[model samples]
Target: MTALNSKTITLKQLAKTIDHSLLTPDLNEEDVKAGCELAARYQVASVCVKPWDVRLAAGVLAGTDVKVGTVIGFPHGSSTMETKVFEARKAIEDGAVELDMVINIGAMRSGQYDYVRKEIHEVVEAARGKALVKVILENAYLTKEEIARGSQLVEEAGADFVKTSTGFAPTGATIDDLKLMRESVSEKVKIKAAHGIRTLDSLLEVIDAGATRVGARSTAAMLDEFAARYPDRLG
Candidate 1:
């Protein structure tokens, strides 16, 4: 593993760390298609799209190294576990290789740890090993303690990544939240920072704080700036 914090690595390695986001509700088919093209061009880690666009993105990204991912329970994580599970299966069937599911926020805030944990486990099980599960803590709505607890539940449920936000929240991933989440889970679990990583500086800052993956809307600007600043590392 190239140290996650190391700046001396291939542009492809750094690009692989970004999950290009195209989840805005107003985006239509053309927008998604163009986004997929850009993702392939950059060889991003994945493109997180709305559920309906999963198939489209899957089609566009076929034979490319970039993966397809979609969200479950979305900006708000209040859906029934059953619905989320079904969504997980549907997304996988539609060619999503990664699933970013939000934890039930009300349940978590109520300290319903069992329910939260059970839901995450079921969603993972729903994937049936076909997709990687990234549990969104939606840190914007959580207290520091809740964030820590959420991180624990995500790992306990066997999810691959513990993510910070859904990007619909008032705030997004913060360095403190990333550090805390990184500390909360064992090394087996990865941290994904989303919801405010807009610049190369911010992206690098989050990785240094312990994010192995990030959700970013400013994908081109960040990568272009990176290439400019580190031409020597564009291997």
Candidate 2:
């Protein structure tokens, strides 16, 4: 992964920090295929696709460094805990190496933290050794206190990363949220800021604020910027 708390980066390290997104509902199969190709060419961390497209992404990304990732409970975190676990297992079976699951937003806002913790823990258990679990707090819907608590819950549940928003949220990752999340969890759990982060500068800003991964759609542009600006990193 790229350095999470600094500005320094290499082309590959920068690429490794991006989860190139293709989770939009409007994308057709060909669009996803093309996106997978683009992700491979850019050498990004993974291609985060919808659950249905996991197999396609895995097939295309096989033998390449890019991994297959998909959402669980998706943009909304209303799915039942049992349903989320099943969804996670199914995605893993379909070759998803990473799973970004939305925390039960309503539950967190409702102060049902134990319910939230159990839900995340079950998914983590389901994904154990099979895939990495990243919990999306969907910061747009959470208060600052809720954000910190959610971050702690996610880490306590043994998730691999704590993510900001769902990209469908009204707002996405902010530097303050990133810093708070970083402080809430030990280095053991990394941070992923999604939604509205597109350019290299924005990506670096999040990383500098303690994000270890970022969900992005402009994989090409961001990597291109890195290449142009840091030619020495190419080697």
Provide the overall lDDT of each model, using Cα atoms, as 2-decimal numbers: 0.94, 0.93
Question: Which candidate ranks first by TM-score, i.e. highest?
Answer: 1
lDDT of 1: 0.94
Please write out the lDDT profile of model 1 over residues 42-121, one tens digit for every residue.
Answer: 99999999999999999999999999999999989989999999999999999998999999999999999999999999
Cα displacement (Å) at residue 154, model 1: 0.7
lDDT of 2 by residue, 1-235 (tens): 3354434578888889999999989999999999999999988899999999999999999999899999999989999999999999999999999999999999999999999999999999999999999999999988999999999999999999999999998999999999999999998999999998988789889989988799999889988988998888774
Clashes of each: 0, 0
Off by over 4 Å in 1: none
- For each candidate in turn, the TM-score is 0.98, 0.97
Worst 10 residues of 1 by lDDT: 1-10
